[model samples]
Target: MGSFHAMHIETRVTGFIEENCYLVSNPDTQEVVVIDPGDDAADLAARLRGQNFKVVAYLLTHGHVDHISALADLCADFPAPIHIHPADAAWCFTEQNAILGLYPAPRKPDCPLVDATEGMVFELAGASWTVLETPGHTPGCICWKLDAANALFAGDTLFRDSAGRTDLPGGNPRALTQSLRKLAALPDDLRVFSGHGELTTIGREKRENFFMQF
Candidate 1:
């Protein structure tokens, strides 16, 4: 498929875990979408201070604390509605989950949280995106596929050479394996921007990622 326009992508590694927060924008139009604003709200805000981009929405790949630590802060600063899968939204606001024990306090998004369903389509940064239900890292883990840009925001599902750990709550090895298979079947040239670590291509992952073999 041909791209409608060129999209510029900037990755910000945030939080103690070094999670990646992606700023996707259409340079020509200055429309932007913020993905997984992990932490370091001050830094995030500073980065966008002089930017001419208009934030359309905030997209969450999953509800993991590390990936959402700065959700409330970012929303407070940008005032954009957040989109996340319903399954993970249930545990996202509470500190009852095992992973929440690691954090000092529970986080509640300051902005409205919208449920994102598989196959849902939305436009951002002048490109159309299709939501893919790729679970296993969490019950509601999702990947946003921007076919026009040939990019996928894969949140802790299928990483560079490894997959998200299944020992955490809601994690299922079998489900992860199935999810990997689903991702592996996508176009080889699709660029993968994962929750953590460097960006990778589907082709490289299919050939080198051990999880893809499953």
Candidate 2:
């Protein structure tokens, strides 16, 4: 077994709206990935210090304000490369200009944007995660698939009962519907780890998620 045999991948729901920030690490390697450090920078950093996990990279599921408020703070302390899809990258530093006008906290990005490409893979805890573009809630929204853990880190594109609103800038109702269709087709056994709210499974969503209904 690898160091991550019993790895502690904790998820903290921070910010006023309860955005999810995931800390994934491999104890053996002491390396970790921080996903969506939306708020409470000091608190998040403290948690990292306690775990002694060296943050290797910062992953943004989208550029929405609630999902990126603590980005600068995370970048400052970890100094890890920031990765995001190019579509919504410009909104990172300019909340006032966000198409949705819902950027809760605005801060500039420390490094240039990192493109989330198809087939692009990143390793964590000796396992791999594949990035899948699933736009609708945002033009650059992405879902990270951790097949080893049978988890899908879905951003605002998907939820438990309903789907993300396409009323915001760059949001397309038709596109969102199409994206939902794609997600609906995934294996029912895959665990659906959303950016907000409670955790669910693809099977549960398929059967009860009204938005994903065919």
lDDT of 1 by residue, 68-156 (tens): 88778777778887899999998877765435335544478678888899999987667888899988988899999988778999989
Pairs that collide in candidate 1 are: none
- lDDT agreement with native, every candidate: 0.85, 0.79
**Top candidate by lDDT:** 1
Candidate 1 stretches with Cα past 4 Å from truth are: 1-5, 97-102
Per-residue lDDT of 1-214 in model 2, one digit per residue for the tens? Answer: 2332545567999977798888877777788878888888899989888878888878888888888888887777777877789888856567443434445446685755678866689775577878988888888888888776677888888888877889877889988888888888889998777889888888898899988788
Which ten contiguous residues of candidate 2 have the minimum total lDDT? 96-105
TM-score of 2: 0.91
Highest-TM-score candidate: 1
